[model samples]
Target: MSIGMSFGLVFGLTLFDNIAMGLPLGMGIGIAIGASLDADAKNKGKTI
Candidate 1:
């Protein structure tokens, strides 16, 4: 899920840059989820 979100955000940003012009919505949502996961992992004492 986190990975998916990251990919989605990347894809969205890329699309916005006209590099792909794909799904921005999915990208935004994915980024949010990924960020949350990253935070969680860091809090868990995991190397992010």
Candidate 2:
């Protein structure tokens, strides 16, 4: 999933910037996604 997101981000950003900038942006997005999933996992089956 990270690889796919990275590839998509790279492809999308390639139109505006170089691969260098796209790489970090993709990584940041992937990390954000992972973190959100982790948060959801931690809260699973719990009452708020």
What's model 2's TM-score? Answer: 0.65
The regions of model 2 sitting more than 4 angstroms off are 4-13, 45-48
Steric collisions counted per model: 3, 0
- Lowest summed lDDT over 10 consecutive residues: which window, candidate 1? 17-26
For model 2, the local distance difference test gives: 0.69
Candidate 1 wrong stretches, greater than 4 Å: 1-22
Q: Which candidate comes out best when scored by lDDT?
A: 2
Candidate 1 lDDT over residue span 10-32, tens digit each: 77677675424445556667678
Pairs of colliding residues, candidate 1: 5-30, 8-27, 15-21
RMSD in order of candidates = 6.3, 4.4
Error of 2 at 6 (Å): 1.9
Model 2 Cα lDDT, one tens digit per residue, 1-48: 486467757765776567766666677777887777778877895433
